[model samples]
Each structure stands twice: as C-alpha cells, then as structure tokens.
Target: MSPQEKTPATLPWLTDEFLQKILRDAGGHETTVVTSSDIKPMAGGGDNYLSTMYRVSVKTKDKEEAVSTISLVVKLPPSGAEMMKLIANSSAFLTEIKLLSDILPKMFSLLRETSPEEQEEFGAKCFYAKNTMPYVLIMEDLASKGFRMAERQKGLDLRHSIVVMRSLARYHATAIALHKRDPALVESFEENFYTDSRGFVSNATLPMLRSLAEVVRSWPGFGDDYRGRLLKRADTIYDDVMELMKPEGNAFNVLNHGDLWVNNMLFRYEEVTGEVRDVKFVDFQLCRYMSPGIDLQYFIHTSVAEEIRAERVGDLLREYHKTLCATLEDLRCADSIITFQELVDEYERKALFGFFVTTMILPILLSDPDTIFNPEQSHQKEDEAIVTKRISNIHFTTVLKRLLPIYAKKNFF
Candidate 1:
C-alpha cells in the first residue's frame, strides 16, 4: 500500500501529493518523488491548548535535482466534536488561516513598496492551507531557521523587549498603511474580541477569575477587604473586561494581537553578538482590529519582566510609541496615527484590561513546565479548582501581590 493508504489517525492528510505541494509552495522546488518522511506530535502545555501541532520532516527528489528535505509544522483545529464546539464557535482557527492567507500578504506588499531595504519579514510563510472543514495549515518550521521561543518562566528583559517594541511598531505601521488604502481592511475581523464571541471568551475567562479569587482569599497577608474586592470583581468580570476591550468612538485603532504574551512570540538571535535581532509573532487566531492599547497593555503586563516592568512601564510605552511613530512616518501613515500623549491616555483607561488578563496569564506562564495542566481536561468543577490552585505557584502569587496594591490604588479592583 502507498503512504496515503497507510495514513494513521494522527496524520490523516499526509499523502505523497501533499508533501509535493508543501515543498513546491514553501519554496519553488518541484519534486518527482518522496523518499522519506517522519511526523511526530509536538509537546504540549498551557500554550498548546487551542490546537494540536505536529512537526514534519519530508525528503523529496526531483529527477533533475538532488534529494531535498523540507521541515514544516502542521496545525489542525482541536480534535473531537466537543472540542470543536468550544473552539469553532469562536471561529479562531478560521481567523488565523484568513489572516495568514489574505491579510499578511497585503501587508508585506505595502512593506516591500514602501520600505524595500528593511530586513524583517512579516509573520511566518504558510506553505499549505485548507480553509474548509477538516482545515489544516502547514507552515515553515521556524525552529529550523534558528528561531526559538523565549523561556516563559524567565520573561523578557529590557533589550529583548525593545526589539519586540520596534518590530511590533513596524508590523502595526504596515497594517495601518494598508487599512488606509482600503478602509474595509477590518471587515473580516468584525466578529473578533467582543462581537458574538461570548462562548469561548466568557466560558474560559469567568471561571478562571473565580478560581484565582478563591486562591487569593487563601493567601496570608491578603486581608478580607482586599481579597473581597477581587471576589466581587469576579462576579461581573466578563462584562467588565469586554466593556474595556471594545474600542471607543474616534479611537486610534490597529490590529491588536489579542493574546500578546511570551509564548506567542519567537526570537531570532544574531549568531556572534547573541543579541535578539528579530521577533516573529505566532498565534494570529486572536489578531483583531482594535485599539493598539489592547496589544500594548497585554504585552507589558504579561510578557515584560517584573523588574523592568515595575517602574519603567511608562518608559516602555513611550519607547513603543516613539518607534510606532517613526515606522508610521516611513509608511506614510503618520497622518493617521495616534499621538504619544494620546496613546498614554488610552493605555491608562485600559489598565484594568491588563490587570485582569495578567492575573490569568501569570499563573500558567510561571508554572513549572512539567506541571502544566490541560485546560481541555478541566471540565469538572473540582478539576478546575485543582488546576487553578496548582497554577497559583509562589511566583504567580508574588507577582499578583506586588501588582494588586497598585491596581487597588487605581481603584481597579
């Protein structure tokens, strides 16, 4: 039997023809034969909850050319009908495939015309994609290109974060430039963050907040008054956060990477200097058109190191805006961008969005990798309580303790 006939449940779509397509699309290579192939499930943790991933290695040979190997990462929507109901209602996987196939290429076109000499490439190269049912997205395995994810536990320091700030500004600038060219650029993301996205967002967030609140109530130095504040907030947090996430009238908006945390980004280092030279953001499922503050606040609070973040968050915002303005100027979109003061004003108004998201993100971010809990497996009430308790590691509690007082003073809790 051929490889296609011998396909296992794990790799239902790995046919010889599919390998040919991946090689041809990823690069301009046409192959005549598939010589070897290997596929394996990628290790999962808190970061891999929404989808399943497999790393593929395939070797192909053209009659005229020597054998060549292609490394790829294939992403499939979560398995099982129940998981489908949870994720499909949000339309997240389709959103990501759309962004990769339709929008990003347009953004890259604008970049090439406006700033041809720039080195950084926009998001990863999608070699193969199926947009219908049983959808699959195959992309270049960035790890093979010397790009790697940063350690979630350690978080990003100043230099690393500056690299992110600059790259993010350029990406945002290209997007703004494109949006101006076509005002309907945001039409596809209309159902994003707050619109009819209640199922997963509400189902996932509210319970996590309640669980965190329970653990907070158990902490020693946390007084009942302070703990009660969070407990009360949890009752209405779904509405509270959704309200904050929506863009106000006449707001300066761009595409927000809704889940902008450490794991969603990968860094490429300069070989000799060992300096982080480039960053490629992953997980476009959450990308949406909204106030840039949504992305900024989520990133600063959840991804930046606590030491650099405590006193210098303002500085970081200024840095981000400065770079944003400069890139906008290059893209000729400066006239459409928000002023630095305006961005700071918006950031303040959205501070609670950060506080709420950070509380949920930190626990998983700082949790022991070996102890990562599967969200899909926590359907039971008791399992959820246990997951939340385990997620509240010493680091998780310390980070929250330090920030809670600050948030309280701001009257956020």
Candidate 2:
C-alpha cells in the first residue's frame, strides 16, 4: 500500500475516549461528555521540523444543552518513517514532552505560590500531554485566542521585541526560582539540544558551519586565505558551539527557551493601535538549561532587523536585564547572581552562537512553504537535495552578507 493509503495507527491521546476525559477534567465537570469533531491539520511554524499539529474542535455537555465549545491544538510526532527516525535519534521530542508534562507545571505552581498576585502572567498552559512515543501535547489554541505570529521576513519591530523580551525574562526567572527552591527538580534539565551530542541540532552544526564557509568563499572580497581560515575554523565549530552553550561558573544560567526566533513566539495586539500587548512562546522541543544569552542572542540574530539590532541591541539587552531582575526579585530568588554588566559580558562572549544559528535557520524562516521541500510529499533522496538548495537561496545569502561583516568586526569568528 502507498504510504498515504496505509492506515495510520491512532495515537493513544488522540482517541475520542481520551479527549472526553481530558475535556471534562479541564472544564471541572467530570460527568460532562465531550465529543470532538472536525479534526484538521493546522499550519505550523516552520520550526516544527519533526512534528505535525492538528486543530480539534470539542463540544462539551452533560446529557443536555452544550456547555461550551473549545478549540485545542494537538501536536504529534511526524508520521513519515524517515522523519520519525530523525526525531527518535534526537532529544528534542522527549525533552519537550518532559518540559510540558513535568517541568512547566511544577514551575508554574511554584511561581503561583511565590507570587500569587502575578500568577496569571506565567507561561502557556498545556491541557494534556502523553510523553510516550506517538507523543501528543494538547494545548489551548493561542491563535483562536487572538495571538498571532510575527512575520518571519519582516521580523519583529521594537514594541513587539519589548513584549517578547519581557516574557522571556519572566520565563527565565521562574527557572531560577525553581532551582533555588528545589535544585534536584531541575537537575535533569541541563541536557538540552546542544548538550546532547545525539540531538538533531548538534549533529547539524558541522554541516551548517561548512555551508557558511562555502558561502564565505563566494563573497566579493574574500580570497583563498580568508576562506582557508574560515574552513579551518569550521572544523572546530561544533565543539566551539557546544562549549558556548555551557553555563559559566553558575552566574547567568537559567532554563532557556533554546529556540527563540520570531516564529516560536505569538503576540496579541491592541486592535486599535496595532500595538503588542501580550506574548506567548510555543515549541518547547528545544528548551534547555543554559545561560540566558543563548535565547537572547538567538532572538536578536534570527528575528530582529539589522538596523534594529545594530542601533538598539544594547537598549534591548538592558530592558531584558531589568525585567529579569524584577522577576527574580518578585519570585524571591537571589538577584545578585549576575549583574547587568555580567549579562552584557556573557552576551558578547557568546556572539558567535548567533552567527552560527542564524546561518543555519534564517533560510527556513524566510522561505515560503511552497519553495521548501516537504518530506511528507517527496522521496528522501530528493528531499535532501531540495533542503540544501532551499537553505542556499537568495534570502539566506542576503542575510549572511548583511551579518558577515558585523561578525568580523566584532571578532566573533
């Protein structure tokens, strides 16, 4: 039978029986019988490389009139065998399952206890999750609630950037509070995508760096010597990248939203002025315990426009540090672990990280879905070639050209 024609196995969490139980539990009415219908695929952000998402409409009632109708987004592992193999080889899927199922709830509960008045400002809530393979995470549909994704090509403007920075600060501070209250709980969080050698991102680093080196060789002013130096450096790029991801002396470490580009965040805007009011982060597959600079630098490089990054990066960092300090203070955690100066210093130390990740991800972020390869539609061999070509497109080259000199000037290479 063709791959499409073969009946796909139903994941345990996707069954109607499971949905009824969770829906009733969420509504706080155990006897309510929930019926789900119109299950359809949701267009996901390009970052969800190893999974697919579905929007499910659920009607809940207790043998009478409908009590309420709810929409939920269900994330499931990739169904294609090749894609499933990649996910199985990496830590991303399991890490996210643990994050949503175990860590986030505990962190949210602790935050509520420490700052009851501000409890509402915590992270996104997962309605239900099953950590086993054929993993599933059901979360409130942020899009239905008026949260929209930022444009990947245009990137985030100053106001949106501020909202996201504030949210990230609150998120990082929660980890700090949790660590202080119960160190053992956060012990396992240290092994993130970068730290795990078997993870997809870590394995992709060398090839991506080599691709960057190839791009550099074709630049106008670059010659053999420059290309040689870059190629030599590329040989050690993976190890260097991994080292940068490590926390330095217990100073500025926190549980970082390991992937923090524009596509991973959703913002709700004020309808009148079109100003950003609140933000929600999604796709925790890469969440890790690392220095805050990992997320900070990643977002700046991948999501902010060049002019905004060059002109206001210092201001943005200051804003992030201020919010982080306030959050830590509110949570009653030690605020002196890292000063603003130290944060800046750490950001500078890890500047190369932004360059590396941007080169690897910006193409996928900027390209349209039609232009990119779809593993579900294409053969594995053809998809590999298409992905390589997609990453080397004009959008990727343009951003690389814009960023190369900045990295050189900063001595980040």
Candidate 3:
C-alpha cells in the first residue's frame, strides 16, 4: 500500500473531515489554530506510536461558563512498516485504550466521591473520551494547570512512597471488592478488556534472552560455575519471564498497572499559586491482570534507589499488605484479601520476576531520546540489546544478593 494509504488502525477517530465536523459542531468562528506546537515527548512505557501533544484555543457561546484552553495528546501510528509489524503483533498498542475505557466508570466514581486525600490515594479521573477510531484522547490537559511530574531526579521520599503505596492498595482493593460484590460485572469487564494473547517480549523475546545469556557466558572474568548455572537455567528463566501470566491455583489475581514506574503519575498542582497538589496516574497502556507481585516488584525496584530499596523493601511490602487488607475489610471483602502469608509466599515464588521487569524497563527509563523522539535515527533496539545482555548479569547478581537468601530461607527452589 502507498504511504498515504497506510492507515493507522488505532486512530480511527482522527481525520480532516472529523476535525472540521468537531470544529463546526462546536459552533465556533475560525477555530483559531493557536499554533499547534508539538508537546515534548514524554518518557517510556510505550511500544508503538510516535506520541505528540498539541494545545488548541477556541471560543464558544458559553464563554462565561465554558472551559477554554483545551489540550490533546495525539499518538500517530508507527512509521516504518517493520515497526508497524512489530506493533501489530504486540497487544500493548490498542489494548491500553480499550482497558482505559473499560475501567473509566470506576475511575470516574472514585474521583467524584473520594476526599482529596482519598482521591490522591485511590482515584484516576478520565475527563473525556474521544474514540473516533485510531483513537485520539483529548483529555483534561494536565499541563495547562502545571500538574506534571519531573522525571526521576531522586527516589520517592518516605511520605510520597507511603502515599503511593496506599493509593495502589486502594486501587487493588476496589477490584477485589467489585469481584466479590458482583462477580458478573467484573467478569464481563475482564472479558471485554484483557491481556493480548501475544507480546513481542513473549514470542520474540526468548531468543534475544538466550542470545544475551550466551554473550554473557562468553565474556571474560566470568567464573565457570556462574556461566554453567545461568546457561543451564536460561530456558527456565526465559519461560518464567515471557510467560508472566496469572499464577495457577489459589493466588488472588487483580488488575495491575503492568508498568507502574514513578513517571507514570502526573502530580496535580494549583497552577496559579504554583502549589503541589494531588497525584493523577496517567498512561494505562501496560495495565493487565496478574499477580500483585508484578506491580509491586516493578514499582519498588525501579522507582526506589538501592539504599532506600534495601531499607524499606520489607517495610513497604508489609505496608502494602496491611493497607490491602484494611481496604478489603472496609469493603466487606476480608475473605478476598490475599493473606499476609500468601503474599510472602507469592513473593518468594516470584521475586525473580523483578529482575525481568528491571531489565526490560531500565532501557526506556534510563535511555536518552526515547523511542518516540526520532524514530529513524534512534538505536533503541540496539541499546536495548546491550542493556539486556548486561542486565542478565546484574539481575543474576541481584538475585544472588537479595532474592537468593530469601529463597533459600524459605526453601522455595
């Protein structure tokens, strides 16, 4: 197909005709372009699309009551055919938008009724949905109010950490309560929106993992036994990482923000006064149904510093468990809460999962000029290969130092 004919399936909502219609429908004169300056590309947690943000200024009949200074974040479809093919196979692309729509009601209710403190703790406000096809999210432009988080300059402080922990607890608690209160509603929602059956990291990642493992084995200064153990266990490790689905048996699986790193949250602020306000979670692209460990592991290891991680790892886990239990209790969902014992047990069974996420994520987190910055010139895939090769060693050592003893103490092989 010609380049012009290479339609983006994800953005069915955007078209020249549609923009004219929206402009006409708004009954505004000329719809002053206001100079569509490109919003700076944000970091990480995306596989497809070159995301750009634009601000539009317009006047309407309800000027006294209307909200002006509308903002929108446009995600154009992937550019290269190769890249598009890669995206076509990965579920993260369209699933993120679909999942957002499914969970929007619960989010809206939480935002509307919850206290400011409670809102900070358990609410996500989705102001509007612009699903025209190849979806365009003309959202509550947070930047208009100066409510945005600067990228990780330092670790999450104790107060903020606790707030984030509590917020996560409330989010998971609501899901469990919903499940218990109305199983069919939860099931129906899950049915409508669930994980993609395939991910590039699943079908295409194992080979890369195996190649990286081999490269590590060949590197100098590596001991014989270290090489042997990693290679021998490579298959098992790859299997576990790629097949990071819901655990079988009695584990309580809930909705997890599959990529819950620190940057995903936008800190709400009082624009005029320049005061810090509430935390609004953004980027639901990687949300999924999985063990809570997946979310907790990604959040703690990636967001917190090593020293802080060491000091507060157990404390934070305990805090998360307690908050989770209390929220369940408040919702009359005590029976559904994953027990402290079970929580610890799952941690043991899945601490290795942290390594997988840390390695997979660090590239996007640490790399400069993210994937969307300049698609043609960037070497994200190459840089990712190097990081993957090195992270396996770092991840193994991290396991040996932090997770191994715990595994041995619990005798969970």
**In candidate 2, which residue pairs get closer than 3 Å at backbone N, Cα or C atoms, i.e. clash?**
none
- In candidate 1 the C-alpha lDDT for residue 396 amounts to 69
Compared with the true structure, all predictions reach lDDT values of 0.75, 0.72, 0.52
Candidate 2, 60-175: lDDT as tens digits: 77766657777788888788886677666667778877777678888788778777675544445677877777677888888888888877778778888888888888888888
Candidate 1 lDDT over residue span 1-413, tens digit each: 57755555767569767787667665667545777777878755766767888888877888886877778889987785656666666667778898888788888888778776865676788887888767788888888888898887777999889888887877777888888888687645765634456654555555656677677676676667776787788777667877777755578878776777888888999999999888998878888777788888888888888888787887787778888888888788768768778989988888888887766555655667655755554443436645576557766666687887788898877
Candidate 1, residue 23: Cα displacement in angstroms equals 3.1
Estimate the TM-score of every prediction. Answer: 0.92, 0.87, 0.69
Instruction: List residue ranges in candidate 1 displaced over 4 A.
Output: 1-7, 25-27, 31-33, 193-197, 218-221, 369-371, 382-385
Clashes of 1: 0
Runs in model 3 lying further than 4 Å from the true structure? 1-67, 88-90, 107-133, 181-199, 202-222, 242-244, 247-249, 269-277, 368-413
Candidate 1 C-alpha error for residue 244, in Å:
1.7
Residue 336 shift from truth in candidate 2, angstroms: 3.9
Clashes per candidate, residues 3 or more apart or on different chains: 0, 0, 9
RMSD of each: 2.3, 3.9, 6.5
lDDT of 3 by residue, 1-413 (tens): 32223224433344434443454454442443321222333334332233333333322333244333444454433556554454455545454555455564564354444333343423233333454433454444565655676455355665556656767777777776655655554443232112443333433333344444455454554445434544555456555654565544466777777667777766664668755455656666666666788778878766665556778777777888898887777666667877777887776566777655543344345433333223332324445554453444442334335643343354322
